[model samples]
Target: MTEQPSAAAHAKTQADFAANLASVRERIARAELEAGRTPGSVRLLPVTKTVPSDRLRLAIAAGVEWLGENKVQEALQKSEELADLPHLKYSVIGHLQTNKAKYVARFAHEFQALDNLRQAQALQRRLEAEERTLDVFVQVNTSGEESKFGLDPDDTVAFVKQLPAFDRLQVKGLMTLAIFSTDQIAVRRCFQKLSALRDSVREINPDIKELSMGMSGDFELAIAEGATVVRVGQGIFGARALPDSHYWPGFAH
Candidate 1:
């Protein structure tokens, strides 16, 4: 069994969360400026995957209106636990199986890791049944890593064209995970590839504009490459116990 944090420990954690949030915002602003973009051009998405519900409540209290979760079941539980926070919205940022579409349709305001048609069809049917619409981003494996869950960059444009048929699903933009590496050049190349892919797709579908890329370590490079949404977790919530390889297979240690 896990031990609960002491009251003083919990208080310290909340204070840490507030401080981390402010620091991340400042970093984002600096990154945007370095990239010659407006201060608020990129939105910081706090990822709450694996975080306990009580700690998440503290995050919501710290003015995090939109939460990103890597697992559907966890997000659902958190949503239920914090249902009173009407302003809070959840975005599913992890790879999703078609069978789990109903869970996302039931509550998620956005789905960021959409890669295949079967999952799209499933989500469309579920959203239709729920009488709702969901904003989705086509996930692309810009890093060309076989272990990553995203459509091939070359296939993304054709794939996106087919999404309009699913009236209940709105194609908001594209999302990608840069290569996890200590080498900044290798990491930036991944973001650059995604940005280039987005540019090409944009010409064909003018409405698809958002590029959800970046994470705690490489968001600055992503911002320089025009990332509109950065999914930050560790930078805000502190380090998670899991290693990067657990989340992204083949991630460099």
Candidate 2:
């Protein structure tokens, strides 16, 4: 059998995790201030993709109220294990498969990356079947990168026009992934596009109120561009262990 960590080791791990949470919170506050927004205006969803449930609970105890997971199965398991933590809210912030809508509808409070109308329809069906309402955000391809999975900027208006048919789902705002590049201007441009898209969407439908952008790497620029929700993973929790070759859950490396 493998050696188990001692009580002292466990305590130290929790302490380190607490310290890291403090540092990340400070950075988030500073980013908000620089962007002319209050720190309370931003919601930090710590993506705990491949991390252990125990460590996730440690982060929660350290005052992490929002947690994000990519896969429905993994999140389901986490929720089962962390069921007693009432203060923490879980979110689905990845490319959601239509078939998996049932799982997300049951567990998540917010579904961040709803890309196409079909996915929205799927979620609507599931929510109706269960007699529930879901809060969802439209994913925008801000970078104009073909590899990303969101609606093209030109197509979003038409798509949003069709969303009212889904009675069980509510459109909260827009979410986007920036192009990974060293140039800050390029990153900022991606965020600006998302902001512009939000502006147009809100002009037509004032209920679309959020912009979920930024990750661990480009979150500062994203916040500067008015991101109300920022997903930070590796920066808060250290590097994650890679999953077996068969599946790669959506997360930053």
lDDT by residue (tens digit), candidate 1, 126-237: 9999999999999999888888999998899899888889999988889998887878789889888888888898887898899999888888888989999999887777
Looking at model 2, report the run of 10 residues with the lowest lDDT sum: 1-10
Q: Give the Cα error of residue 71 in candidate 2, in Å.
A: 1.4
Q: What's the lDDT of the predicted structure labeled candidate 2?
A: 0.80
Candidate 2 local lDDT, 1-253, one digit each (tens): 1121111112226666777666667777888888789768988888877766777777777777878887777777778888898767788887888989998878788898888887988898889888889888999898888888899999998888888898888899999989988787898998999899899988778999899998877787888899998888766776566753423454334
Error of 1 at 161 (Å): 1.3
- Per-residue error for 78 in candidate 2, Å, reads 1.2
User: What are the lDDT scores of the predictions, listed in order?
Assistant: 0.83, 0.80
Q: What is the lDDT of residue 41 in candidate 1?
A: 90
Model 1 lowest lDDT segment of ten: 1-10
RMSD of 1: 6.7
